[model samples]
Target: MAERSIQEVRAAQPSRDGDGVAIYRVAGMQHAAMDPVLMIDELRSEQREDFIGGFPPHPHRGMQTLTYMKHGGLIHEDNSGNRGEIRSGGAQWMSAGRGIIHSEMPTVDTRGLHGFQLWVNLPAADKMNEPDYRDIPAQEMVTLAAAAFDATVIAGNWTLDGESASGPLQTLAARAGVLDLQLQPGAAVTVEVAPGDSLLGYIYAGSMLHEQRELGPRQLLITSHGERWQLLAGAGGASLLLLRGEPLGEPVAQYGPFVMNTAAEIEQAIQDYQNGRFVPEARPLQ
Candidate 1:
């Protein structure tokens, strides 16, 4: 197996979204090689005012969203009549196949809101399929533990102690994996990624040494082609998220909440929303 090397390191840019919720955005449409993975936003704050407003009602199309909560909680409701709450250590996966209107609000009077929202693009073939939703509690997430490291496998598979653990999110058009990893001081781990897959690491706590370079909090590291990559935690240890996916290599036309292959498609999405074509009667999930 070949060793993967760090190709670039970029700082997460500060931005506000969803009714003024502050966040650190790591990647977006400008970075094409990151296809299938459109954006990653880290929202962390102990101040109640920072996330109180939450993400009010909004519409999305041609993509899927994965929200992982590390602390605090989020209440989600959509026009499809799906409603759920994601507490600390829980996650919500929503596929906005054709279109959907939804709102994600912070639990009332809750403090210490912290989590991440990742946007994954859909292939053209499945872009307009029926929307789907999944809420995964922390208890149901696969755990991989070693002497010095622990990880929550939200998507894809991981092998530890000679046994394999697979996440609940198995069906994705782009075929991707999401892992939340924590390493103790001086700990090291090597993860295998398939050839031709794009791999990214977002450091959120402490630091790590990758190929002689030190990556600290809020840094996004992109890796070069290889079968595996090694990560070593710094003295204070490290916490990070690992995302891997196959590139879609398709044209992306995005406008607000809609993402499509061309301007015409985006226009159609807008027209659909305006005509109430995407608004399904809100029926609470049974």
Candidate 2:
């Protein structure tokens, strides 16, 4: 029943990734890692030049990624012979347990590509497990509609009026929760979060009042430990992404796409990639 206060507020930094796809990088702003969450990138743009190049093939290890698309489409291909398209209102969750080679490219000739890519860290114990993937379409996700607010549950459960909505991603190692929330003018919503959980929110449209502070677009809000928090939309209304997860509280060693527990493990990941041991053609999922 304690009130949640904002610990910090930071504006997203502009950056480019995946073949010049422009994005606003939030989280990981002040450190190499942020407990269970590593990075969050807001990729929303209407210009073709901002995302035409697309992301070529790449590798990842010891991490989980959740890609939620709101306005555009992305085609994903992995070395394990898995391929899919995450269209508007769809999502894709991929765990690069031990290692995985994959590529996510924007759908060509499409404008207004907008979405978010969130990176969640894997604990050391689950870092070497088998890689896995899950794709959830828009229709499959749970939605809660009300007169004052609308929300979509992406990776956890939300209950209102004795009805509950659950997301498809349930097996995350970090026990993370993801939600997309939209509030009409003067509307407010309270979200319950456990004490000691790392909670963060990114505002993409309009502004919201949280803990007596106003957060505007492109700003990231970090919350202190509390039982619950309340967010009230400004006059223009607001759309925000909410993320919460228990902290891993483990040492992290990261080098580019490789994340491990020690420097030696990071080196090993590099050597594996160089020697083709991590490639699909070399190992070939059995």
**Which number leads on TM-score?**
1
User: Candidate 1's residue-wise lDDT over 132-228, tens digit each?
Assistant: 9889998898888888889999997654334467888886558888989999998978888776888888899989986566779999888887888
Counted clashes in each candidate structure: 1, 0
Score candidate 1 by lDDT. Answer: 0.86
Could you tell me which residue pairs clash in candidate 1? 81-283
Question: For each candidate, what is the lDDT?
Answer: 0.86, 0.83
- Model 2 Cα lDDT, one tens digit per residue, 102-196: 88888875788989999899989999887888888988888888887888889976543344677777866688888898989988777777777
Query: Model 2 scores what on Cα lDDT?
Result: 0.83
For candidate 1, the TM-score is 0.94
Model 2 residue pairs with clashes: none
Candidate 2 residue 42 C-alpha distance from true site, Å:
0.4
In angstroms, the error of model 1 at 191 is: 0.3
Q: Residue 227, candidate 2: how far off, in angstroms?
A: 1.1
